[model samples]
Structure formats: structure tokens, C-alpha cells
Target: DPIFLSSFWQELFTLQGVLLHKSTAYHPQTDGQTEVLNRTLETSLRCFCSDSPHTWATQLPLAEWWYNTTYHSTLKCAPFEVLYGQKPPIHLPYLAGESSNDMVDRSLEAREAVIALLKLHLTRAQQSMRDKANKHRSDRQFMEGDWVYLKL
Candidate 1:
């Protein structure tokens, strides 16, 4: 676990513009997003490798791909779209009458539409999350040196 606090990991996150926050021990809720993603990943792995549990590792990439491309309730858009500004294309079997040029054109058009939709979804999702969080938040304030019990 100490390895996670090493300079290498810290530098890696810094380069990616990620801030690593250490959560309280035994408090998974403190990192709610990670907990939810982990649960989703587990469910995806189960669905993908139910018949061959030993092959779960091999199916991990596919599961991750599916998870990223799937729409999330909180985000209101696929994670892939939010990050890349477009939905990832699924490989479908070519139709007998479809030309490569047509496929390419359709793909580009679809990407544009996905990016537009993702923008709207992101705005709505942010507002929804803000409202939900505010609903349960307390107005209590604590100043420096104020006595507070730390949960162990």
C-alpha cells in the first residue's frame, strides 16, 4: 500500500492532471465514485465471463470498453464520449450493399452528433448532481481549532 504513495505514482497522476486524495480507512463511501465504478466493473465481468470464470482476466479489456461506452445515470452520457468528445464505434458486420465510403461518412456524422449530445448531457448531469448533493448537505460550518470527533 505504501507503494501507492511513492514518487512514481504521484508523478504519474500529476502528469495526468489527477489529484490523489487519500480516503479514511474502512470508509469506501468517502470515495463514492470509485466504489460505484468498481461495482459496475464487477457486474460487467460477471456478465462477460460467467461461463468461463477463469477467463475473466482475458475479458477485462472488453468489459472495460463496454463499461466506458455505456451511458451512466449520473453522467447522462458514456464516459468515453465525455472524455473523447465522441462515442466509440462498435464493429458491426458490413452489409452487402454498403460501401466503405458510406460507412466512413456515417461514422463521422455519428461522432459529431455524439459530441453535441455529450455536451448537453454533461451540463444536465452536473446540475442534477449539484442539486442532489445540496439536498443532503448541512449548512454547518467549522472554523480552525474547532473540536470535532474523528471517526475511527
Candidate 2:
């Protein structure tokens, strides 16, 4: 199952113009931020909804929206806001009175703004991932008289 899933992930990445370079899997650490967020989501939904076990499927999206729109414990800003420098439009109501239909013009401007923000987010995320990977490699590099596990 893992082999098949790995190949699938590789293929998916290849479609995105990325190459799969495999060596050994790195041990995962329990990052506090992620753990806290997961716990918050689970607890919130468990307390809020009790009708179905599939409640997670319904609540997860809302939970993500709330989480991303609210300030992070460490980051000091909402995750989406931090990434994009502003929160994306959550909900809005249309007004009844309009003369020249400025709504269309504003919508186009908003779309262009979103595209620009997305490009910026992608660039930043890529750089962050690259930095983490490089740091991991540097930390794991074997030194003289140091013992390391060989992945055989």
C-alpha cells in the first residue's frame, strides 16, 4: 500500500514538474503549533456537533476557515492573513441600489488582487520549505566520531 501510494505521490508531483528523489524517510516530530491546532479543531467540533461521526467532514471546512481567519497563538496574526497580508473575503451581501454597476469593476479588481496574493504566497511557501529541507540536511550530516543509523 505504501509503495503504491508513494508512486502515486511521485506521479502527482511529476505532473507539477517536480522530481522525486528518494533516500530515507525522516522521523517526524510533533510540532507544537500543528498539534495545538489539531486539538483545537477536534475539541471544537466534538463539543459543537454530536449528531454523526461524519460530522468531521462537515465541520472540518468551517473549522479550517475559523482557524485561518483567527490569530495564531505564536504567529500573532491569522494564518491566511499572514500569508496574504489580508484576510480573503469570507461573506458579503449584495446591495439593492446601484447605478453604473461598480460591482463588476470591483469584482475584477478583487480577482486580480487575489491572483497577485496567491503568487506571492506560493513564492514564500516554496522558500520556507526549501530552507527547512536544507536545515534538516545540515543537521543530519555525519561528522567524525559521530554515530548514525544506516538505512538498509
Candidate 3:
């Protein structure tokens, strides 16, 4: 709270176009998307820091990078893609005891799998949006002499 209330923090937020809103106690629904992202980031951090815990600070950057590179169904691409106007650069992640060739193959396979998953997610998201939009819509017919708006 003190950090957010500081003049420096206020200026930084203003520069970034971030508007801080007062959150209600025990009301996560008010910021559903933010809450979802927080939960995801927390889960990823927990996974990364489970062994060392104290090494979370070191793992934070990698986790952040991984998150930015991951595909988003709504966006139809990773956040990195939107910001950089291209896909995240491909690289072989370190795998203990694996040779360079094996690592390269694994990296390629992982990317292919991620691409497939992104496609699947996009299809589902589209269907969900269509269903939600259809909820308030109905087929209508107009005929001669049907009531319609007229300019006075």
C-alpha cells in the first residue's frame, strides 16, 4: 500500500497508462481477468520455486519470459508476438544429459505441440464467444406494414 501511494509510483503508473482502482475486500470477481492472470503467475512461480523457494527471484525472469511467449486464445498469438510483431525466437532449452542434436529435436517437437494446442484453444474460444453472443439474439422477420422506426 505504501509503495502504491508513493509519488514516484504514481508517476510511473501514469507514464505506463495504468490506472489503479480500489479493490474491494474479498471481491476477486471485480477484476476477473487480472485475478486469472495472478493465479496463473502464482502457479507458475510455485512450480518454478518449489525446490529452492529462495531462488524464486532468480526464476521470476524466466517465468515472465515463458508467460509472454505462451499463446493466448483471445489474442490468437503470444503476448510477445503482439508486442514484437513476430513469434518468440526458437531456442533449445537446456536438458540435462541430452546432446545438442537431441535438444534441438526436442525443442522443435515442443514448438509443434504448442502450435497445435494454440489452434485448439482458438477454436474453443471462438465457439464460446459465439455462444455467449447468441444468448441475447433471436431470429426476426419483417413484413409489409410491420412496425418500424420513423423520423418525425
Candidate 4:
């Protein structure tokens, strides 16, 4: 499908800041990151707008903030922090009184949080894989005399 004519497509391309492929019908995995990001965006939108579907326009900014501020397990940093060296300002009205000094502190906190989150996720994933490997090794039923057809 042509995207140049669509403002939605233009905005997507601009925001992504890179050229994206138009994947073949049965092999969408060629654009895996785009697919993953789309899913993430949709999930963020849905979760943020659950209480006000009709007013989701107002929730998009917050959703974007959350997505950009949170650390990505694979990227090793929050999207915004990776791109800008600092997380973008979150639009929370309750924190409107924050000063420039406060922002400096907040950015430091955000960086630490991102690092902690990444470490936690990495630890959990490694532990899960180790557990699965141990279980598989323990459950093996091979016998010394058994003839097994191992596929090469």
C-alpha cells in the first residue's frame, strides 16, 4: 500500500526516523521491530485509554511518555534516554511545581531506574532459561542401551 499520501503514514515515518520495509504477506518477520513496536504502541494506547476510549487522544501523550521512559530489555536503555541522553519530561500535572534543579535530580533518578529495570528483567530471563534447562536435563529418559534416532 502507498503511504506517502497518508498523513498517518507520514507521521509514522517521521517519528520512526528511518526507512521501513513493506513486508511480504507470509513473511512479516522481516520488519520484526516495526511489528513489535506497533504491538507495544497498541497495547500502550489500549491500557492508557481503558477508562476513556473516546478520549484516548488525551492519553496518547502519556502513553508515549511511558513507552519512551521505560527501559527496553534488549536496547539496554529507555528509548528517550537512548536517543536524547535523558528521559523526556512526563506530563504529570501534579508535578508541575518541579524546578530546573528538580529536573536534574529526576533525570538522575530516571537513569538509575532504567538501569535497575534492565538488570531485573535480564536476571529474570536468565533464571527462567536456567530453570527450563535444568528441568529438561532432569526429565531426560535416555537409557544406555536404548537406540534413539537422533535427527542431525
Candidate 5:
């Protein structure tokens, strides 16, 4: 059943522009950030479903919202804000008195600020990741016919 499901998913994702990479069993690094995101989502689900695990499905949207609103160490900004250029406002009865036009203007200004910050954060994160990765890597050259053991 799982094999069939996996095959179905592979087909579905490929059709949706997702790339599938074959990897050795138990190798999380092969998928890079996808593995990290899965761990984070699992942790969030566990926290949300402590009392009723069956309710996890109902809590998924809330988990997604929390994840999107939470700041990432590398990104230095909430995922939603980075993508949309502004953070979604929390419910505030007091702010209901403000005119819609004023709110729009304020949101636009905040979005511009956030976009600037996001660009800076992205650059810094990229450089840091490159430096860290290079530290663990070695420079090597291989001839066309050279045999190298590929780690599965």
C-alpha cells in the first residue's frame, strides 16, 4: 500500500513541478531543507496534539499559520512576511476605529521596510551557509575516466 502511495505521490508531485531525487535509506540530508521543515512540522503537531492526537488534522492549518508567522533563524524574518512583504495583523478591536485607507498606507510602509530587511537577511544567510559548507568541503579535480565511489 505504501509503495503504491509513494509512487502515486511521486507522479503527482512531478506533475506539479516538484523534483524527486532518489536517495539512500535513512539519509535525511539528501532532501536538504525539506527534512528540516518536516521535523519542525512534526514538533508543532506533537505540541498541538498532546491531548488529542486524532485532532491533528484539524490543527494543521493552525500549525501552518504558526509556522509562517514564526521567525526563522536563517531568514531573520517570518516566512509569510518575507513572501508577502508584510506580516498579517493580529486581531485588534481597538484598531477597528482606524480608516481603511490609513490601514492600507501603514501596511504599504511596513511592507517596504520588511522587503528591505528580507533582502539583507537573504544575502547574509546565503554567505553564512556557503562559508559553513565550504569549511567541511575539500577542493578536488577528477579526470574524465577517474573512478570515484559515490556515497549512496
Candidate 6:
């Protein structure tokens, strides 16, 4: 993790005009969204590297791509699309619909239908994930100076 704070990364970010804001340590739920995303990514890495733990560093790019291109219910679009104003050119295997034609038709109607179906599937998947995550969660409120345990 120290590599992220190294001079090489700092120089690259500076050359690209990117700003890096460090997060505070020992803070309690200052940014719940970030906390949730970090937990999700950690679980993903655990599963992905469970077999070959040493290969995780090499697999990070693939994880990042999957996250960026996946539908975010809150955003209503993939993160990549929001940043680029267009969908990322990721070629997933064509769904085996009714049948396949030797010659593909490059028509607007076909593209529109495909986009619509994709949107529907992504929405459903998002709902499913939300449902599963909320199943074990409860509405809990804590006040200042409440005795609570931190997971660290």
C-alpha cells in the first residue's frame, strides 16, 4: 500500500493534473459510501485471490475494470460512461438470443434493442444485490460518546 504514496505515483498524478486527498485515520463513518465500497472491494479480492493469493496485484486491473463498467444503482450509469460521456468499448460475449446470423446487421434498431435489454438486466441485478445486502441489516442509531466497539 505504501507504493500508492511513493514518489513515482505522486509524480504521475501531478503530471496528469490529478489531485489526491488523503483520508483521515481513526475516523468513525465520516463517509459511509466509501466505507461500503471498500468493504465490497475487499470481499471481492478475498474471493478472487483465495486460490492464488500472490497473484492479487496482477489481478487488480481486471477488478478495477469490472467495477468501473458495472452498473451503479445510485449513478444510473457505469462509472466509465460518466467520466467519458460514452460507454466503454468492452466486448462481452454476445448473448445467444434466438439465433445467430452469419452477417451482423449494423442497424440503429438492433443497437437500441440491445441497449434497452442490457439496461433492464443491470437494473434487475442491482435490485437483487440491494435486496441481499439489506436482508441482514437493521436500522440502528448511535449518539455521541456511546460505548461502541470498533472492528479496526
Per-candidate TM equals 0.44, 0.38, 0.44, 0.41, 0.42, 0.42
- The local distance difference test score of each candidate is 0.73, 0.62, 0.74, 0.67, 0.71, 0.69
Model 4 ranges with Cα > 4 A deviation: 1-30, 87-152
- Estimate candidate 5's alpha-carbon lDDT, on a 0 to 1 scale: 0.71
Decoy 2 TM-score against native: 0.38
TM-score of 5: 0.42
Clashing pairs in 3: none
Scored by TM-score, the top model is 1
lDDT of 4 at 128: 97
lDDT of 6 by residue, 9-62 (tens): 999999999987766766536767788877766655555565566866755565
Stretches of candidate 1 off by over 4 Å are: 1-21, 24-29, 94-152
Ranked by lDDT from best down, the candidates are 3, 1, 5, 6, 4, 2
Global Cα lDDT for candidate 3: 0.74
Tens-digit lDDT string for candidate 2 (1-152): 36735777878887899864443333223455456767888865554344354645655665577667877768877889888988667654333343257777565454444334545655877999999889857545667999877888
Q: After TM-score superposition, what is the CA distance of residue 6 in candidate 2 from its true location, in Å? A: 17
Candidate 4 is scored at a TM of 0.41
Q: Tens digit of lDDT per residue, candidate 5, span 23-120?
A: 66677788887798878888777765655678777667766777898888888899998999998667332332255687766655543443345456
Candidate 5's displacement at residue 96, Å, is 19
How many steric overlaps are in each model, in order? 0, 0, 0, 0, 0, 0
Residue-wise C-alpha lDDT for candidate 3, range 50-152, written one tens digit per residue? 5456866766666688799999999999999999999999855454436468767665564444434545656877999999999998888889999977669
lDDT of 4 by residue, 1-152 (tens): 66564888878887989675556665647877767876887776665455456855755665677788888888888889889988667643233235468876665554444434545656877999999889856555888999988879
Alpha carbon deviation, residue 46, candidate 6 (Å): 2.2
